[model samples]
Target: MSLRRILKSWVERYFSDEEALILLLVLIAGFAAVIWFGRMLAPFFTALVIAFLLQGVVSALTRRGIPHLLSVIVVFLGFVGVLLALAFILLPLIWDQLIGLVQETPRMFASGQNWLDELQSRYPNLITPDQMQNWIGVASREISQLGQRALTLSLASLGNLLSLIIYLVLVPILVFFMLKDREALVGFTLSLLPQKRALMARIWREMDDQIANYIRGKFIEIIIVGTVSFITFSFFKLPYTALLAVLVGFSVLVPYIGAAVVTLPVAAVAGFQFGLSESFVYVLVAYGVIQALDGNVLAPVLFSETNNIHPVSVIVAVLFFGGIWGFWGVFFAIPLATLLKALVHAWPRGMKGRDERHHALASEESMEESL
Candidate 1:
């Protein structure tokens, strides 16, 4: 086929449908907004996400014979209560843990240097005096700079504190109004769009369910994993248990990579605190069990009916989105990947098949293989 013919064929095959065009434009606009005003509008976006998550609870309450306003109020209050608890109790505990961890750093380095020295003595050929001295020098410099960096970060955090306060105040207000006026908000948003939104509506319906399930499941996973980790670490008398638990909980946001990367800190803390004692082994085993159960059992149950994108697609989404949007990007990687998968599968082609759904499935499978 001629190049022009191939181009025409591809466009017709994938983009001839008006719905596909609309979807493409919407995605482009959404991405642009995120890239452009992501930091400036962080609170609004955060509020939107909280509203989305809480919508399910509000809906459930309404279904259980509660009035919508009452439901919104109840859910909003519950959310505020959690926020208050985090601010007053959890935040202070984590802050102390962070300070303790920082204070322990010098000792940790000393212990590490001792180990390196022992290794160098045992393997003279492998690690010479010059190399050992160089390593120690680098470590000392890092330790020295650590205090300076912490002070700088402390100053920087004051600015971040203002932003955080804005978020804490604004997010709840936005969420409350969003929940209370859900229909008005939806109607207003839909009113701004063109009258014909068949394709957009279909995509929204699919995305709404998937996104809701995914978000709720993730929140549950984080809470379960974090709480369990905190309990386990506390029981084992591990230092920085709260901080490490929070890290482990959030690590689930990145699937396989998260668990592995977070294991380093947990093991390091355990080793530093307890050396090779039985408590260290027990801590590691318990941590391993939490990860295993989360992956093997919890995730499967939670996401069984949600998007089923390949692991490769997931990792790519994490790298791509996380590169662009940083932490939140990595956090929402899977859902975003699933959204793309949905768009691809649902993109209308001019050609007709005996079974259209089956054809879409086949096309999606082909696309996945290419990816």
Candidate 2:
């Protein structure tokens, strides 16, 4: 076939289906809105997510014979109660732990420097003075950068306080109405959609189930891991148990890397405190068990269906989305990746089998090779 014929074939394969065109247009429009006006619509988007998460609870209660409006009120109150507890109970509890860690920082730095000096003294050939100096310089610069960022955020907080207040005020109101008027809202949205939304509905169903499981499973995982870690560390009389537990909890946000990074501090604290004794071994073993169980057992149970995306794909998605949207992007990277995969799998292709398309391309390649 000529080049023009190949181009026509490709266009027909991609764009001949009406449903595919509509889906493509909708995806483009949605992405455009988020990319162009993300900051402006962030609060509304945030409200939508919270309401979507809480919908499960409202639905569960409704199924148990409770009225929809009553369920909404009950769930909303529970949500507010969580916020209050975080503000009042959780903050004060962690504040003391933070202060203790801050106070120990200088001591830890001095000890680290002394240790480096000792290493240089003992292994002059392996660890030269110049190498040690360079390492220390790098460490110092990194610490300075971290401190500068914190200071910048502190200054930014004051200017952003009104925005924060607006979010707090507006999000809850939006969430409430969203939950209370859920049916009407959904009806309105569906009415706006195209009459033939079979493809859209299918995508919605798949996304709904997976996203719900992923989000809820994550929330539960964090709580369970954190609570277990806190109890285990406390039982072992580890210093800074609260702070370490919090780190371990949030570490689940990043699958493999977070746990590994956190293990350094835990082992360091244990080694400094216990000096390679039985208790130190015990703590590490316990931590290892928790991680093993989470990876092998808890995660599998929580997410019954495999996402079928590779770890490399996951990491790339995280990097790509996180670069665009920052923290929230990182958090939702897996779901977004899964959504992309679903879209690719479901995209119309002029009724051609994917394998057939691949075979045709391979045949062309073989013909070119022979020629």
Candidate 3:
């Protein structure tokens, strides 16, 4: 076939209906809005996510014979309670531990430096003086940089306090109304779209349940992993237990990468406190067991309903979306990846279905003419 004919055939196969074209435009517009207005509407987005998380609880409560408004109210109050605990209780502990960790950095570095010195002396042939100097220089520079960044963060946080206040005031209101008026809000949103939305409906049906299950499962995993990590660290008498536990908990957000990255701090804290002793070994072994169980058992059970996405695809999605939207990107990486897969699967099915209908119509016309 000629290039023009090939192009025409491909377009006909892919974009045979206005639904396909409209969906493409909607996706492009949605992405552009996020890229442009995401930061400005962060509070809205955050509230939206919080509402999504709580909606499941509200639904469950309603299913259990509670009134819808009562369920929403109960769930909202619980959300507020959790937020208060984080803000007033858990946060303060984490913050204190973080500050303590920063203050203890110099002492940790000194111990590390002493260990390196002893290693150099014992392995003089293997550890050249130049290499030793280079290593020390690198460590010194890194510690210095960490201190500088911490200082900068402290200063920036003051400016962010106002922003935080806005979120505090606005987010709850938005979340409450969102829950209370969810059906109306959804109806309004749907009204904005074309009446003929069979393809869109198909994609939404798949994504809505999939994304909800993924988010709920993920939060549960984070809580379970983080709580377990905290208990384990406390058992080992590890310093900065709260801080390290928070890291370990949030690390579940990035799948393989999160666990690996958090391990450094856990091991460093263990090694610093107990050196090459059995305590350090035990802590490390315990951490390994936690990770193994999480990956092999907890994750599978929680995410059984989610699509069987490839590991490489998951990693790539994390990197891609994380680069695009940072924390939220990383947070929603898997769901976003699932959405992409849904779109890919949905669009082809839509086109083929439309093609079949068109052929059927043509055949009917031929039969009528023959009659």
Per-candidate TM-score against the hidden true structure: 0.90, 0.86, 0.93
Decreasing lDDT order of the candidates: 3, 1, 2
Q: Alpha-carbon error at 136 in model 3, in Å? A: 1.9
**lDDT of each model, Cα atoms only?**
0.87, 0.84, 0.91
> What TM-score should be assigned to candidate 1?
0.90
Residue-by-residue lDDT tens digits, candidate 1, 1-371: 89999999998887766656776887899899999999989888888888878999999999999999999999999999999999899999988888888889989988878878888889999999999999999989987898888888888998878877988899999899999998999999898777766667777888888888898899999999999999999898888988999999999999889999999889889988887679889989999999999999999999898977888888899999899999889978888888887776666666552147456668989999999
Candidate 2 lDDT over 73-190, as tens digits, reads 9999999889778767886778787767655765655666777898899899999999999988987786678668767876897777788678878988999999999889999989
Off by over 4 Å in 2: 1-4, 264-282, 351-371
Tell me, by TM-score, which candidate is best: 3
Alpha-carbon deviation at 34 in model 2, angstroms:
1.8
Query: TM-score of predicted model 3?
Result: 0.93
RMSD from true fold, candidate 1: 5.9
Worst 10 residues of 2 by lDDT: 351-360
Worst ten-residue run, lDDT, model 3? 348-357
Q: Report the backbone clash tally of model 1.
A: 0
- For candidate 3, list the clashing residue pairs, or say none: none
Residue 169 deviation, candidate 2, in Å?
2.2
lDDT of 3 by residue, 169-278 (tens): 89999999999999999999999998878778889999998888888898999999999999999998899999999999899999999989988888888989999899
